[model samples]
Target chain A: MPNDTLLETRPVPGTDKTTAVAVRTHALSKEFGGRLVLHSLDFRVEPGELVAVVGKSGCGKSTLLRLICGLEKPSSGWVEVGGERLSGLSRHARLMFQDAALLPWKSVKANVVLAAPRNGRRDRAAEDALEHVGLRDRAHEWPSILSGGQRQRVALARALASDADLLLFDEPLGALDALTRLEMQALIERLWLERRFSAILVTHDVEEAVALADRILLMDGGRVTFETVVALERPRDRASAEFTSLKEAILERILGRRS
Target chain B: MATESLSYRSRLINLAGPWLVPLGLLIAWQIFSGSGLIPRRILPSPLEVMQAGFHLTLTGEMPMHLWESFQRAIVGLMIGGSIGFVFGLLNGLVGPANVLFDSSLQMLRNIPHLAMIPLVILWFGIGEPAKLFLIEIGVFFPMYVNTIHGIRSTDPKLIEMGRIYGLSPWQLLITVVLPSALPSVLVGLRYALGIMWVTLIVAETIACTNGIGYMTMNAREFLQTDIVLVGILLYALLGKLADTITRALEAWLLRWNPAYR
Candidate 1:
């Protein structure tokens, strides 16, 4: 298998920065009732980079993603994406939740096209998005009628419908069965390759992080604890010793204490 | 064990049980009166009840009373149900406006609409307005609560999905929230219509010159037990007809839902 992992840190122009950063947090801190959730955090990502954010539950993984997505206000810092500051970009860019949040009453197609501009060719775009997600045959089915995987597919289709530049995912596949999760990972990776949306996925699965991420950003104590550039090849064989070695190395870094 | 057979038999027995008691009660009354255990006038035979019922039906008087009753019920349900639906939808969806109305609504709801009958009589003088107001009050609260409950219970995750997809707020409410709320809202409508029927009977009994309630009351004064029984039976029949129609509408509207089938 061909090694597919690629990492880039070239920042974009403007905002007095020399390199292109898809996402950046500058000395970010968040506090809730004087209890600091995230303290003095700084991070940056290049365009089209698939960064996996892994952390134990309640380690502020979700909060970090929410902050970047502008769903929550930071205590005292800023998030920037695609050279546009968080305060500046339109609401088009944001996160996909863990739950398959397809509206129960909407047909698969309608859910996907929900964000399509009124002036845009909604019918065509909706159909195309559903097709991309391999749910074309199920377009007319209500979300309530769909199986779990199919509903998640509609949610994925909904997120990608806008064809936005930045995508934040917080444990989007955490609720799925292992088999379904594997299929969804492939679907997502394929779309990432084809569309090149700068993506961040938050998950606790070390194997999943190494499997699909360009660089795994392991977080602890609300800070980036470890960054691993997955060297495994495309369609990486899970049983292969080389992949296992890489996985073990990342696992040690994720679970083991810092020197 | 014979658990499965026991369950089957239990269900069968329960289904047939209610009818059996009524039948047995009728037979005992007839036998007792015929045996002179009780006088025929004091404890009338089932035959006497049937004969009186038949007479009223044949005379067209029962039909007349029933027609009036049904007309009032239909009018009240139409006016009250529609107004309730509109206001309920408005209160549920419009947050700030809902807050503004909530306290006042809660206060007004506390005063039982039935208790206002005397005041209503004074205001409207035994006419349509008083009756309609009673029915409207009966319908409003259940619809309002169900609508608000439905709106609040919508999955927040679904709203987030709409946000990610860039759906406008209006589109989200129409395509997502409203449809998700439909089943509960329909339940409210069904209950409100039931209340409207009850309210119509009350309104008719108070000041109406027509309707089954008045006829039944009049029959009691004249000791016309048969007319009274016929009126009661007619109310049940008409109520059941209305219920069946709504059930049919519910089935038709929600045919796409597996639960409906």
Candidate 2:
């Protein structure tokens, strides 16, 4: 296994200051009804880093994201955000799910505004977030009328509206069709580049991992068994040899373990 | 010319589509009653019923009875509906409240609310309270059951999303849970409206001195079948009106829902 866990505590590329760590888990483990789902493990995410966790279903990828977001408690170890131990649901973390769980009763902008920080100008925040997702015109439309991709965009805008430092994505694009998936991937990358919130995306698609992640973690049997950093430049070419090779290597590792 | 005539026919059907069945029935009824196929004392002609309605309306007698019935239904509905709403909210959101109330309420719901009429009369006599109590019992269950169903039907995913977004418990109930429950709640309200009229009719006919039901019973004593038919038609019309109002409420509240839209 090529272990490239060397990048640690590094300052984000565009930012000048060495920011605090976005998330850190010390021997984190979780079990449900005496069934161990996530084994004891250590994990870290740097500020502004986009970490993608790719694994087969039920391999604890979703559980890892849930634990990081404090939706689930660690059965053994503790999770830290910004170097502070998390006691409950992380106030600093925002989560986006695969279903784009927008409130069906609220307008698109109202849905976004519901997540806006209370102390700020919520309406303006909602407008800015919708504008970022290119959904300014759809602010007044019901979520039910939007396409699947557009709903996810609104969900993204909602997460963005809340000025959280960490964003946990649980297979946010898994439900979209191929073309829409590509468009969403580009949009996510552009937004991540612009905002630079530390993001942990749990996905099954290795290509998506290669395309979007700063570092890719492969989990099998409830443990992070392989780690690699994507050193590719911005606007990475999927057709390029480096991208294909990296994608193939990860797919092989995942499928290789299945047999 | 053929296509144009067909289009004209279709346009006319579109204009009169909803009235066609009722109009046909009315015409057939008029012919049968006017031709003396049925005894006038048993089932009066539609025209006679209309005349009775007009006479009652002109004398302001019908309006007074309608006002009394309307006032009773509205007051009973307000009290019963609020009680059901509060209880349903508690039972739906709180585990202990559900455990304490759900099964008992379900048991009570199985018994016909009309069956409690004798007991209600015994408790409150033939006064306004007796009529009000019957309407309250009739209206309570549908609202309670539907409210619980609505709250329980709320998508768990949306609640999780709300929490992750830092919505307080109160905010979650207001923004996510309540909106999710609105459609089901509206359905309950419509069902309750039906029960309200049914209860009032029975109570007024058996005991009350005023209301549409009392007017029908009074007409029975005088053998004025026309007035009786008028009262029956009034109930049907009021029921339809209640349904329309409930539907409009659904459309307004659930405009975001594609089904309602």
Candidate 3:
């Protein structure tokens, strides 16, 4: 399927110095009530890499994210983050969900602060994170008053405020409209570029994976079935031939075509 | 500008609507009683009720009854509400607690609290303890049921998020679980307030020598129906005041809730 030949050889800008591995999963598997949801799989994410996992519904993408984030225990096998084995939720990693999940009782800034570690400069860090997501003015407003897009932005700010070394996105932009999705994609790209934190985004949208990731993995029947790397440059042109071809290649793998 | 004026006029009418009927009834009673169609002994006029209320207030008799009743209600509410809250939290969060206490409490809840009065009196006698016991029993069930429901019905997604964010168990209760359960808890509190007055009235009428209930009972013996009416009015006013205060508290605490806004 030309999978080995498709690995992008392009050097990631501003990330050459760090040889640190951010995440490593060895033969991970999960089952619920005797039915297997995630098959034994080996995976690794290098520091500052943005990896995308794409698959259809019920294909174990979300389960993989949950396991990596320590929200779910593996039925067997182990996960290592920042070179240490994870027991429960890893302090080095943060997760963003599709639902935003901001505490409705708290103000936007307080929601961000809730994820931040206690310190003298905690509020300053939260404010900076909110400013990064362009939500500085909305810091004191309740989550209920925010629009769906704005709420997601606040959720992004919350992840940023956490200051975790790795970020997991579980279809965080799946609920946005077309225009908002594009805006969020750009914002996510900008933030990932600036912070250089390792990120793994699990999404159903093939074009989004091409637009945002350094590499993309396709999962099916509870295992990674296809892998490809995006060779395009940052601020990638969606209308460019490379972008379309890359998206087409991922789509073919997802659709079960051996191209 | 015209629409603004129209809305203003409608707002005024809305504000005045509730009072109009009561005012009309008062005026009609005064006119009819002044004409002497009905004997004053059978039904004292509204003026007589007001005068009795005013005279009682000036003599400090009404204040004494009111103060005694208020103290009892507050003490009972504080004791019963606190116990209910703690039990609810325990049962809702811990599986063993739920298994041990929930069913027993539910079974006990089904029995009418008023039905326990004679037993309560026998156990505690016709003193302050008996009256307090009745009020406590009356208020406890609603608070307990509501707190359990509130804690149990908290959104699982939010709790999951709290775990992911590394919130401690206490933080989770304070931030997510408690706030989510607040509306239901407030509803329970309002319900308990109504029951408190009802229970107190029954307890006082049966035996007490103080409180508005005792005053009403005393007036009934001498056929001082005006004073009796005044006592009833005082109960209605107190109940309304409690409801208003509870509503205001609910609004302030739940200001972040979109449904309230």
Candidate 4:
């Protein structure tokens, strides 16, 4: 069994401490009451990979992210993060919601600090994370006073402050205007590149998937129906032929399924 | 120079705006009483009420009654408020506690606390305990209802986020749950302060040796209508003071809330 091998290559300390953790699900399924939201489907994300799951609303994309983060349990089958099974909330993963979901009572910096591990260095870590999102100057301000994009940036900073190996994003830019969405996409891409954390981004926007993910999974009827490898270079040019074709292909599939 | 004077006049109007209505009413009151249109016994003029207040203050009687009333209010609030808070925290956060106690408390809350005066007197025999009991009961329900409502109304998404972020149960309560519930809790506190004075007024008037209510009763028996007016005005002033303090508290604690800002 590769179980022994899984133990040996477990991102040993003093050797690539920033090495991202792998996520795997074995025939994972989730049922709410008597209704099944996610079918018995298998999925995986390689260490340091940026994978996007695109689908129509209510196709269980958000459910999958919640399950992976261990916020909700699978009704059947199981999930493994970095080789071990996810029993409760995942210790190595951070999930960001569509809404900024900030505590209105806390300042931006305090919200980020609240997520950082209780090492004595939490303040420093919060500052650094805020710096990464270019919100360091606004750290002392309340989340209420921030613009939607700025609030999302603070949320991103909060996730980064935790230093988790896996990041789960559920339509993080779904509410932003087009210009803000494009800026957030670039910001997310840059952060993913810098941190190299394993990310599973569930989005409805095909162009967003093309601009960010290394690979894309098309989900429908509570199952991943198709997969596409972008094989495109970083800082993807949306006007380029390869980028346009890939985006169009995925968009057509989603539209075709809808019809 | 013209612009500066205009700005100065606007600033003066801003300062005087809130006092305009009360000042007009006071003038009307004084003129009507001076013209003898209404007997002084029926409605004492503002000047007579002020003079009575001054005389009582010089004799140290007003301060003594004021202190008694103030002490009762604060003590009742602290004791009742703390118990209500504990019960609320327990019922709101713990399922079994809610199942066991919530219905009973809700039923008790429906019974008008002031209406229990006869029963309270029988239980505690017209002592400080009886008055305190009434005030405590009056303040308790607001605190209890609001604390639980505040806690129950906490956004579930934030709780989920807190759990994912590795917050311990206690940390979640302090950092996420409590802070979110605070605005509601303060609203409850403001309501409770108003209730505190009301309960004390009724309880003291019904049966008590000391306090503002007793002073008013004593003035009525002696046919000192001006002193009676003074007592009524004192209660109004105290109520206003309590509201102002609570408003300041809310402003300071909810400073991050844009509405408060």
Highest TM-score model number: 4
3 or 4, greater by lDDT: 4
Model 2, span A98-150: residue lDDT tens = 99999998999999999887987889888988998899999999999999999
Candidate 1 per-residue lDDT over residues B94-163, each given as its tens digit: 8887889877887887988899999989998998788888887888877877877788788877776665
| Fnat for each model | 0.45, 0.91, 0.70, 0.91
Worst 10 residues of 2 chain A by lDDT: A11-20
User: Could you give the CAPRI-style class of model 4?
Assistant: medium
lDDT of 4 by residue, A1-259 (tens): 6999987556432223356999999999999988888999799999999999999998999999999999998999999999999999999999999898999999999999999879648898889889989999998999998999999999999888888789999999999999999999999998887778899999999999999999999999899999998899988999999999999899999989868
Per-residue lDDT for B230 in model 2?
Answer: 94
TM-score of chain A of each: 0.87, 0.92, 0.90, 0.93
In model 3, the fraction of reference contacts reproduced equals 0.70
Candidate ranking (lDDT, best to worst) = 4, 2, 3, 1
Interface RMSD of 3: 1.1
Clashes of each: 5, 0, 0, 0
Selected candidate, larger DockQ, 1 vs 2: 2
Window of ten residues with lowest summed lDDT in model 2 chain B: B116-125
- Candidates ranked by TM-score: 4, 2, 3, 1
- Error in Å for residue A223 of model 3: 1.2
Alpha-carbon RMSD, each predicted model: 6.2, 4.5, 4.9, 3.8
- Listed for every candidate in order, the interface RMSD values in angstroms are 2.9, 0.7, 1.1, 0.7
Tell me which of candidates 1 and 3 scores higher on TM-score: 3
What is the TM-score of each candidate's chain B when compared with the real chain B? 0.82, 0.95, 0.97, 0.95
